[model samples]
Target: MTQDEKGQLKALLRDEPSMRLHRELEKELRDDMMQRLLTVRPDDPAFAALTQFHRGCLHGLHELWGRREQFVKQPIQGGNDDK
Candidate 1:
C-alpha cells in the first residue's frame, strides 16, 4: 500500500468517528451493488435503508477526506528515495 493509504488505514483503525464512517461505507458499497437491481422496479418501501445508508456513506467520505492530509502522503516514485 502507499504510505498515504497505510497512514489513512492506521488512522482509521485508531479513530472512532471513522468506525461509524465505515459502517455507512459498507452499507453504501452494498447499496451500489443493489441499486441497479432495484431500479428495475418502482422501488420497495423496505429499500429506504439502502438509500439512506448510501447517502450517509457519501457524507462520511466527504467529511473524512477533508482531514485526509493528516494521514495521506505526497506521491513519490519508487526509486526516488534518495532525492
Candidate 2:
C-alpha cells in the first residue's frame, strides 16, 4: 500500500469520535440486552424453583414486616411498670 493511504487509514482508526461511537454502541447493546432479560418473566418449568424461592422470600419479608409493625405499634412495657 502507498504511504499516503496507510497514513489515512491510521488517522481513521485513531479518530476519537469513531472510537466514542463504538463505545456508545456497545454500551447501548449491552443495556438493551439487560432490559430484555429483565422483561422476561421466569414462569417456565425450568425456573420453577427460582420462582418458588422468590415467592417464599417475599412472603417471609411480608410476615417480618407485619410483625415489626405490630411491635412498633404496641411498645413493650418494662416489667417494673406494674408496681
Candidate 3:
C-alpha cells in the first residue's frame, strides 16, 4: 500500500476505543466465517466461494494489522507543506 494509504489507516486506528472495537469485530467475523466453513463439504458447490471469501478476509485483516503494527512503531510523515 502507498504511504498515504498507510497514513490513513494509522489515522483510523489512532482512536483507542475504535481500534478495540475494530479488533473485536474482526475476531467475531473470523469466528463466524470458520463456523460457516465447517458447514461446507469440500465437494460442495459453495465451498470454493466460501473458502475464497475466508481467505480474502484473512488476507485483508493481515494486511490491515500489519500496516497498523508498522505505523505504531514509526511516526507518520507530514504532507507537503511547501507545495
Per-residue CA lDDT of model 3 for 1-28, tens digit only, reads 7999878777777778867877896888
TM-score ranking, best first: 3, 2, 1
TM-score of each: 0.37, 0.46, 0.48
Model 2's lDDT to the true fold?
0.60
Native-structure RMSD, model 3 = 8.2
| Model 2 regions more than 4 Å off | 42-83
The residue-by-residue lDDT of candidate 1 on 1-83, one tens digit each, is 79997876777655888667767776767678486547744477656765676667677776766666554445344885675
Clashing residue pair totals per candidate (backbone < 3 A)? 0, 0, 0
Q: Ranking by lDDT, best first?
A: 3, 1, 2
Best by lDDT: 3
lDDT of each: 0.66, 0.60, 0.79
Stretches of candidate 1 above 4 Å error? 1-43, 72-83
